[model samples]
Target: MAPMAEPVAAAPAPPHFVIVPLPAQGHTIPMADLARLLAERGARASLVVTPVNAARLRGVAGLAARAKLRLEIVEVPFPADSGLPPGVENVDQITDYGHFLPFFLALKELAGPLEAYLRAQAVRPSCVISDWSNSWTAGVARRVGIPRLFFHGPSCFYSLCDINAATHGLQQQDDTERYLVPGMPVRVEVTMGTRPGFLNSAGFEALKDAAMEAMRTADGAVVNTFTDLEDEFIACYEVALGKPVWTLGPFCLCNRDDDAMASRGNKLGIDQSAVTAWLDAMDTDSVIYVNFGSLARKVPKYLYEVGHGLEDSGKPFVWVVKESEVSTPEVQEWLSALEARAAGRGLVVRGWAPQLAILSHRAVGGFVTHCGWNSLLESVAHGVPVVTWPHFSDQFLNERLAVDVLGVGVPIGVTAPVLLFGDEAMRFGRADVARAVSALMDGGEEADERRRRAKVYGEKARRAMEKGGSSYESLTQLIQSFTLQGGKQH
Candidate 1:
């Protein structure tokens, strides 16, 4: 076995922490963020990962030495019968277009590594921080005699609807009622640029049950969004879980330190130099940088249409289209055309782009995104407006947050013909996309007003993460409460 890992910082030999995050990028990024947070707060943490994903985790751990964090990374070996191909446990392993329930057996295989690590620890952990997907880890946490803290990392409005709809019932046919959920008189339209019309769909039930159980059973539950963004929903979570719902998030702070970056240097082996140089060359608020995140399968046709659409619009762009997400000849044609047509006008990154630097860059005026919580939050935190294309999960709600509540984005609905800002849907359309983007960028009238409002919201989000902010207070209080309970490792 690999040498038993040890913590980085010194703080009374701190509480040992074991974190098992979901395998997807969205899940992994937040999990890494939380691990970094715990480490910085004087916690000694052992973040577990499959051998295949160790590199990815390393990228997250980067070599940071904050005052109180000693973070060690442990890689769990893959079992022979996992059925997944060799080196296929990471997020980039496959592009199957569905939920991954079929791999439960493979997932459960981690119990052995998890159990072994617990047995080997010199100082046992006070608690286990886990993701919703790793429900089976509850068994490991229980057996290890540690209280578990499950992180949901979801937006409030979506999470609340997940819980409430489970009890109050949601109707399938009604769009208006979808917005006006039972007991929520103010129509919790949490997504940007879209209606809450599809909450009753079958996609949300398992997630709700799993998340609800995780919160109910754990000592405490944590979310990545802020209290101001979801006060009502957090209250709902607090009540349902019968435990404090600490909203110590947006979870983007993990990347704030050098250690976080250093940990990943040897792991990802990313070729970021070219992308960085290209981005540096772009004029302020000019390049349309893009990436659909790790899990989003890039449909080539849609990629082509997007390229075509951007080309037709006569704008500069940077589109990242994953090879796995696109597998057609026509898409190749579009890409070929894009290569020739978009020399100065566009640059497609093809894989993951450094999101943080991109968002903060003066060149990126907006984001065209799949509305994952992190990406949406990143855009909001940076005051960059968005073109929201919700693919799944709480994304639909996040789309609403951008388009409706925040006024920083517009919905580019993602059904039938993939809608950019203005294309009409069963309800909304391209005129919408173009107009919205135009307004936010330079369009006069309400356009400037909306951008101004968006900047204010972004500032508020910044405040939540600052000293004495809601998230900061919540974090301090959470640690204090646990400390008061004797700070004992179970």
Candidate 2:
């Protein structure tokens, strides 16, 4: 009944570009920032998203709209491994380890569906900006003659250190905690860098390998951290990757004010308002805001130790405790015990907060974080000193940069196996955790000096992201490169 066959017209050039991310808030945010940059250079954006992440893509889409950019969304299905609870369509629902393994696999599995969608788009994209999970897209791009852009939503320094460690084996060896990497600038890539009182644990070897593979296949890479935050390191990174590494972020630059939409996308009714109110009530340098960051797990003992440490320090504090992290009745009750004792002085948040905003608030003096690269940048960007508890990956190096190099934060906790199980490990449980907390809370005169220095760090971060700054210039150059036809390097 259908008149089927017709002569096909010559295909026009592909659409502007398609960005495929790992479908997490961390990955989505940076890609959205890049999409805005692409649009500014007059390139249309086709953001390929999985069904679970579609709402988030739409939420970020609102930001592009404000810039008068027409950003399109194309959907792909999550791999069965994602373990989306029976009928749950949203990526936000899978919060625990029960889903993490599967979700990680799903992110990688999404390559095929995304490739199919890219092939059928109205206009072909010049290149593909693929996130960590979708690194497989690089192969697809090569198959179809488009460039592959691997996105690393963290500091260039972190990536540099990770690759360095993989090459030099920075993991703890027979209780020798720190290791020196052969790269220039006399670099040290400790298993968990302990400059003095601080102990950091950097794990997740599986992920480092995956990232290196992705980078190997891609034409270029993008790191969502400013050049100033990791100057010499990004240069080292250019050598490590054997390609150009563009330093673009703290990618929340183009983020919109649509809290409801962002909350929907993030799937946590993150009561950012309450956080601000708590900050408002505190005196300057009075409150130490504690957040383990999104991916950092709170082992019950560590959580309890943190609570007791805050209480013993006698500092005014607001600890953002997520119900999801506790995940059990016993842990919830234990948390309540801490809550009841410290009722008036401390507030525990039920969900997430606008972290950078909270960190920047006048009343907030210090931050306790998991040392995710984004969290590191936020602390530096806001001039909020840190009590770093690095859980995994390049976070250890970030902690090194924070305390050893910049003097912006102090480190606590050792999660390496020997450190956790050895003779000194039990001591680590008590001494290291409490000491780091106290240093940041300093009742000493040095607190004022630290605060002044922190403010300077924040100002520098602002300048870097502003128009005509190094980060801005890097972004502009990156956009120009992508915008050229024939995909020529020159």
Candidate 3:
């Protein structure tokens, strides 16, 4: 037995990923979930955020600690002179629409500091995962000699349409004229009015051009959607981009417990117990959950129409009204009167709502949504059909996917898209809202069929995130690839 035992090689260190998210609630929430998922999977994940954004993620940080996951929140100073007021680090905090462009462009300033941080690190990151909006990360990754992956928050369907439109171009006569979107797997129609407003701005075009260039240089993309949800579109997108696109989420599902759900996004306007208690008292599949996301700005008239619509539908509901929308005396009085009339049947939350928790509740039968991708995926993951009311940027396309392709939603019949500034004339009224709600919630064969389809999709979404499922396998492969690359670099 004289031969000395062969020494075993130590396992390679876990791959470390530095995640950079755009400072918006919708964008950051899913990215936060991705960081948590990576940490849980035995990788070191660090989220680089501004001061305000870091504060918003405190709950997520706590979740990671309890789970014993290697998740870190790295704070970077938000660039000043962005035209936004002090302490206004996020899109949701911007009071004026004119400041939006300034806020967007100012984020590019982060590249210098981010590069410095990477260079100073004792061990280089295995990869840099940045939101597609943060296009500046591409240069930083290049300078640091690390791989980078873009994270797209929108549906694969919307992304494919965006790419095709940019490639083939659209010929439109006017804002109302409908044109067939070129190069889609399915027939999708769009009106010039429904096109994203950013497309009209020269400044935004420059930024967009940079983002597209960054996408080309990046190693690949990871989307916050499951393969089962958009398999065809994902395949088409991969072919178009000629890069691997990984589908590793319904990231909201990573928050498995009540504590995690309640704290998943922005700060809650009301206590979690209060919302849960209200839902607990309602009958199963009885409450309609209403929210238009954090950044959507609607005038007081729109709020009143929504209020009257919920009252007219005669259904129990929970509606999230941004505090900014009700600052005027007229809107306040109108909301008060509506709340009084619909007492015990409807609840209106004034600011941020525990959206994930509300959607997860059994009492939530349907959702009145603005077709934001995160909201759409959450609704699908919970088996809730929707009344679609899209507002601006990618929302109209997302609505088409929900209503036409998925068959789990009914449109509220806003034929024209509105701008982000809430300056456009109101189109849909109370009656439109009531009709869509009734179509979704009323007990009929059609309504039941919609609910059934939603349930099936929800089940498939959950299954895809479990071990041996499509998303699970994709995530495993993604980490393994990074690990191997990291070892080579070492």
- The prediction achieving the highest TM-score against the true structure is 3
Q: Stretches of candidate 2 above 4 Å error?
A: 1-15, 40-42, 81-103, 167-177, 192-211, 256-265, 415-434, 443-449, 486-490
Candidates in descending lDDT order: 3, 2, 1
What CA root-mean-square deviation does each model show from the true structure?
6.9, 7.3, 1.8
List model 2 lDDT by residue over 325-443, tens digit each: 57788889988888898887887776666665666678888888877777777777778888877655556667777777777777675544222211233235545656777888775
Angstrom error at residue 280, model 2:
1.6
lDDT of 3 by residue, 353-400 (tens): 989889999999999999999999999998999999988788988999
Model 1 RMSD in Å is 6.9
TM-score of each: 0.83, 0.82, 0.97
Instruction: Residues 1-490, candidate 1: write the lDDT tens digits.
Output: 8997897754454455688886666777777777777777766667788766667665554454334358777888766776665666755565442324434446777888888888776656667888866777787888878788887756766666666655675544455422334544246533223333222234645644555565567877778988766676678767855677779876775466334433431232234555557778877766655666666564443455566666655556667766664456766676777779778767776556667666766777768787888888877777777777676556777666667676777666554222221222333333444444454555466656655765676777788888788987887776665554434442
Better of 1 and 3 by lDDT: 3
User: What's the lDDT for residue 398 in model 1?
Assistant: 69
Candidate 3 lDDT score at position 378: 96
Question: lDDT of each prediction vs. the true structure?
Answer: 0.64, 0.67, 0.89
* Top lDDT hit: 3
Name the weakest run of 10 consecutive residues (lDDT summed) in model 1: 416-425
Worst 10 residues of 2 by lDDT: 193-202
